[model samples]
Target: MKKAVGIDLGGTYIKAGLVDENGKIIKKQQFPTLAEKNDREIVLTQIEKSIEFAFEDNIEGIGVGTPGVVDDEGIVYEAPNLPCWDKINLKKIFEEKFKKKVVVENDVNTIAWGEYLFGAGKGSKTMICITLGTGLGGGIVKDGKLLRGGKYSAVEIGHIPIDYKGPKCKCGNIGCIERFVGRDYIVERAIKGIREGKKTKIYELVNGDLDKITPKTISDAYNLGDEFAESIWIDVGICLGAMFSGLVNLLNPDTIIIGGGISQAGKILFDTIEKTIKERAMKILSRDLKVVPAGLGIDAGIVSAGALIFQE
Candidate 1:
């Protein structure tokens, strides 16, 4: 069986794996990103070593999923999460180090591609995969192909403006969907509610440590029958559903796959989101549109990264 290397370049860690064509990870390894060091050469060297370790032998090509705007030629224009990745020729570096054909794609796009080929959106012609975590990220597959815009930075659903004058986004936009539904936003809202002395179990859940407030913490509290946490998820689901409605009207895709840590909220989140969509979206577009959770889990990134090379 042919083998490929997939690398998920994250801010805190670099996850690399050797995967076969069937989406099975033959071997996997991880290393700290050490991005704060701000040494591009050192970072690249470390990545190269990690890939080499994962490769071992018989690796045909390499696919990298990075958290940034990657050009078609595999240059990283900018990575907001990693400060040293601006305008870095990641493709050139990897290719030079490994002497193998290398393809670089946006991390979110990688996930979408993975799902379209091996996960929830498999066999769908048009699909949108939304990942709800620390920040909202998305990948759109149209006609079973990744949509690369003029600048190769397409499918940025998170930045879609839901409000023109709402909260300022990290992307310099106002009222972006991410600003409303991302993990930070959820925690911020929860903290604000607690400060207002809203009666809820979140206070005790975090043991009075506001700093410990996280999306998971909120979800856990909600699972334990905390009204405050439950309300936060309800609001999150509503916002996500509202955003998805617009997408459904525009793309009319067969599936909208939701992934990431928060997706574990499961039925509570899905039911609320579906209810909002039913009430807000056009019935014509919403009909037959399936909103489902990603089946790949954390392995999605790794599998998707490898699929990049295998598919080529």
Candidate 2:
């Protein structure tokens, strides 16, 4: 029944929860991040407020999952959509404020570790977990430990280039896997298809308002037997699978876990990725590989933040 406070820091909202050793949330709450204030102190106070909402006496520690590059000392760097977020020692600040041990890590990395311990990847020795949302984010659990770069949490899997000469990514990379399958990119594909005179239920789903289209729209269209929407999801799966093939060859992980909103496309995306990886990756390396959705569901962020502290 050991418990800890978990904080999931995002651009617009902060989610906090009390999680026990079994990865079950005992209590949880949410608060606005107020990052638009463009003041570091304001955002910091928001995080503190979230912690206070979830903290209790004699907890093991507080774990915060944040969006950024986290260094070994729990210092965050280059965090987007936050004011003056460069090189802030969140661990030190939280520890000082609460007199408890603090663990800070990149949000996706926290999710990866959480899955390794309590989710779909519970028994896997090595796992690759990716969240496909507004952007792509990923983390790796290798050899029963969270993989880290030399100093920072370097697993920025979204930025990994799938095509060196393809479309430019927001990160200034050419043909990043995310550039192909990220939320905006996926929506862009649908728009492009519609403009090219491809008839799809996507247009009907949004009443011909292309700007109103989203990945969910496409998913709904696909559910209604729209071939165009199906093709879009398949293409995205291929893009992701192509990138994962290289990773499979290099890391030989046993499981690849896909999460986030877009992953709800269900069987089509997962099956395509699995098929593409099997055909493209080394047969021996991929023969036992499994592509599965994340197990943590809606409260993944909160539970995974707590898992960071519970991880051995």
* lDDT for position 175 in model 1: 95
Model 1 per-residue lDDT tens digits across residues 1-312: 978899988898999899888889988989888888988877887798879888755687898999988887888876887888888888888888888989899999999999988899988888999888888889999986887778676688999998888989989889999999888888999999999999878888889999998888888888898888888899989988888888888988888899988788888899888888878889987888788999787788888999888663
Model 2 ranges off by over 4 Å: none
Candidate 2, RMSD to the unseen true structure: 0.9
- Clash tally, candidates in order: 0, 0
lDDT of 2 by residue, 1-312 (tens): 889999999999999999999999999999999988888899999999899999998899999999999999999998876757888999999999999989999999999999888899998988999999998999999888999999999899999998989998878878889888889999999999999999999999999999999999999999999999999999999999999999999999999999999999899999999999999999999999999999999999999999888877
How big is the RMSD of model 1? 1.4
